[model samples]
Target: MRHSRILADVGAALRFYSRIPVPAGAAEDAFAPPNLKRIAYAVPLAGAVIGLAGAAILIGAHALGLPNLVAAILAVLTCVLLTGALHEDGLADTADGFGGGASRLRRLEIMRDSRIGSYGACALVFSLLLRVALLDGLLALSPTRAALALIAAASLSRAAGMLLLEFLPPARADGASAAAGQPGADAAVRSALVGALLATLLIVPSTGVGATLMAIGLSVLALFAMTRLSNRLIGGQTGDVAGAVQQLCEIAFLMGVLIYARPH
Candidate 1:
């Protein structure tokens, strides 16, 4: 039935995107990447869940008398744990490939390597630092705004990844992205629309129309640049590229919020 497929797809998204458990017997069936591609819209929905959990951690940490920096670090650590550092790993791998590898083929080879390199180490370090710094700023400014920003950033960032999947073919024929297959253009667009709608609603209520527009504009531009960078370096997208997009786009979104979501 159509309903069953939707539930299966939701389960698939959670399994792929988070450390959240799926129904025990359904795990294997939910992750047939082909089936997942059909319902890839669930990506943003899964992100919303992950972000809410992280935001809750932030709130609880602050409530327990933690410093803003400490609470922010705990919140980031919670997300890293909950998602099993899924996008973070992709980011580190992409940095290593793009920064350290000399040739396109070599870049792909580096990304596929299991070991982290110097570039990977540096990328992860800065990513954590930037994320914590941004969240700490937001927390100091207004915890409520920070919570909303977390949800919007998480959803919209994944939407940015969906756009890359829509526009770029897999960088390698045998890679995970190629094996999983990309979403159809229409499906990808629809997913993005859903994500944008959610993000806009989350922001506009608190930040007003102007700030909401700024956040969306910044997120799109950042995604665009990341896509072009991937294309120039590796010819197209891979899972690591998508992951990098998610991480950078999320940071951009949060920064946009921090810039524009001030008391009015």
Candidate 2:
């Protein structure tokens, strides 16, 4: 019963977080609207699933003799496809809203517009470039290590993003963030522990203790910076803000791992 409940939560999380189809019998409530508070513990599991898919492509491309850059690009494309670019869209919208709007109301309105602006376009481009470059660098070091890094980064960044939902009130009363609701403190802690466990198991094995610690520290700093920015700029977090935070933290994690990774 306990194991079944965990599976249900993971299935619900993947259904909520990805474009990947959850078959009808995957779980009893897999298709239901997620209770974000209750299923928060499974967010990292969902991220791990997404990351695993991307890692498969990355390893496959490398096995096919593709250049590291090409392999990294394919891996990133796979992740974007799996999530339907959900967080990417959020990051773009947040960039457009925060960079272009002068007021909180205007910012929320801009985010809701769904139209890509100059800021949004730039953010997307930079985000893609950075991920590809970072992954390429890791791949050049070792494909196995790179795959591990991808999974760890994905899980950790998502856990970091959940902190916003735990700590900040919804910025908009009518949007998805508010409607989906916040996680309880216990739920938040579970999410963090799951993410941290994945990172410790994956990153420490591949990146070494020093690099793994650095990666986690950088991810935390990135999360802190995003939280503060969201609070000061918009008075609280929207879904877009959480998404942007994830993107930033992912990049930061990879950067830390790469910088501190032992000479290969």
Candidate 3:
């Protein structure tokens, strides 16, 4: 890819995935960023940027003499704000629809509703608690290691989401996700490869190669489980399903990292 095309792809991915603003004239510029659906391979690049921002907040808090718990909370909040809780909202809606709906159609209906249900609330609460707790533990090990893990988790989780989009057609005829359409296999593989490379960068440096391989194994398994569960519940996938997969992948990635904790 030309350097210009590469930058535009990153810009498009960043614009789609995060609240961060793109260049002032990216839209009207000659480059004209590619469609999001066509550029799934860039998801990991966008995720790495978001992860770095969150890590900065975490490390900054710790440098300021804050408690690890407090620093972890700050980092979590930073991520939520940076991404506008895009994936988190998707996770909540997916949980509400799948947990409370009586039928497949009903589940799809519930997922599209803007209002949150009891199931959604509970899912959000539980997921947030797990993320915060895990981050706190990771931060205790070392700020740098925790930061790298955040990058890996975010990148790989989004990569997993791309896989969901690649393999499963949209559940509904129309929606943001549906309109984007299913991703091609090559696009999905490229996205996943990017995620793997980034995850390896995070793991191989300090923890060794086994840790890198194990984290990928855990993340891919979680992706498979989530994909199966979504298919069973709704007969297909949706944007919410992608979000849920990202959140689940992040958790699984973190869980794997926790197994090799080394405080420094």
lDDT of 1: 0.85
Give RMSD (Å) of candidate 3 vs. truth.
2.2
The C-alpha lDDT values of all candidates are: 0.85, 0.88, 0.85
lDDT per residue (tens digit) for residues 174-253 in model 2: 88888788887888888989998999999887779988898899999988888888888889999898889889888998
* Deviation from native of the Cα of residue 240 in model 2, angstroms: 0.9
Looking at model 3, report the run of 10 residues with the lowest lDDT sum.
Answer: 24-33
Tens digit of per-residue lDDT, candidate 3, span 1-264: 887777677777887788788773334442343365567888898898898888899899999999999998898889889899999899999999999999999999999999999999988898788888888988878778788888889899999999998878788888877777777888889999999999998878966677677778888998999888888888889989999899888888887887777665
lDDT of candidate 1 over 198-252, digit per residue (tens):
8889988877777677778888998899889999999999988899899998888
Query: Where does candidate 2 stray beyond 4 Å?
Result: 24-32
- Index of the highest-TM-score prediction: 2
Please give the lDDT score for candidate 3.
Answer: 0.85
Error of 1 at 76 (Å): 1.0
Steric clash count of candidate 1:
0
Model 1 bad stretches (over 4 Å): 1-7, 24-28, 34-36
Which candidate, 2 or 3, would have the higher TM-score against the true structure?
2
